[model samples]
Target: MHRTPCTVHGTDDRDVTTVCRCGCGEALPAAPAGGGRAPLYASPACRQRAHRRRRPVAPTTPADPPSVAPLLAQVRELAAVLDAGGRPDPTGVRVVEDLTGRLLARARSRGQTRWLPWVDAAGRERTALDDGDVEALTARLYADGARTVGPPQPSRPACARWVQAWRRDTSPGAQTYAPLELVPGYPLTEVDARVLVQGCRDGGESWASIAARAGVPVAEARTRWG
Candidate 1:
């Protein structure tokens, strides 16, 4: 008598795999020892299918954009205006100076100082404006009725002259003297002349320093002392 192969059934005793379903004379591995449930597979195809069934990832939201661009652009524009050497309104000068200091801080963080010229308002072509100069310009602008919150207009030549006068008078080492002639029209006092001459002597104050202290032009001081 011929014996038939054992049959496998689902855990619930249902037939999940058809027997020789194709009748192709080929046998497939039985599902499970006691049930028709599919066997756990460790093949590449099984892995790929398992990976596809994993939980879908949630999308991410982007961060908010920065808002300082416009302010920085405005600061750059104001800096350009100051760089052009025009007589700026007092209030405008102050604004420029404040903006310049902030911008300079940023530039310095990046290891640069060339931007100083862009914010300078002193019209000193060879050097950048120092803090004292910037403050002076700003104060002068404020005193001249400059609008506090808008683009500043250029001051008139007279206003510019006034600003220049203020700078000259308040500048360090600037002092006036009278009585003796130095330049064709600049008169120096007898005491001032004697002091100036002594200051220029071999071991005395340097002619440059004396000229600076006396507010005399260097060329005139050198000529008179020599």
Candidate 2:
């Protein structure tokens, strides 16, 4: 029998398998022994080519969506308005509207009612105010020349100075007054009388202002000072 140098089969020492020029390809060196197992190439080039064909390239992850920078900027603006201690500007109003919406949503989620405090002239505090109460207070402030319509401007130095004076009078030994209880003959000292006269002479000449400066009720100041 004649044997081919490059082709032989089945367990013979003389059998040799060359790189197959036929390109059906030799069984890879790392190929699993029969029984339907997969083939693995031993040549680096072949392995790399196989890997490129069989393994998938990873898809790139998407970048994070744009941040909450705009919302944060609006919140900062609202804070600035609050810090100024005046009514909010248009931007601030928008922010407040947004916040109010959020708050209402949260309250609805929690099955709760939002309540704000209301103080009465008798020093009683309540959780609600009627239209009448609001109207009365509004009228009173208007009459006193303390209320202004429309947007607030920066506080004037004169108004600020007046506020400072009012604050000073709230301190210990400073004069203070009740608006409704002023009446004549409510005990007055000589010093009190002198202070009352000076207070009247000062810019605090209104009955309420004079009484406040003298540490007496307006009614009392009018009665005694008269």
lDDT of each: 0.44, 0.44
- Our tally of clashes for model 1 stands at 10
**Alpha-carbon lDDT of model 2:** 0.44
Cα RMSD (angstroms) for every candidate in the order listed: 23.8, 24.6
Off by over 4 Å in 2: 1-155, 171-213, 216-224
Angstrom error at residue 152, model 2: 14
lDDT per residue, candidate 1, 1-226, as tens digits?
A: 9966455664444332432343222233556777776533434455466666675978987643243344455556666777997555676657656554544434332331121112224423333235346555555455534322223544354344444543443342233321122212223355445433542342244667656644577787777655
Model 1, global lDDT? 0.44
TM-score (all chains, Cα) for each model: 0.19, 0.16
Can you list the residue pairs that collide in candidate 2? Answer: 182-219, 182-220, 183-219, 183-220
Q: How close is candidate 2 to the true structure, as a TM-score?
A: 0.16
- Minimum summed lDDT over a 10-residue window in model 2 is located at 109-118
Off by over 4 Å in 1: 1-170, 173-195
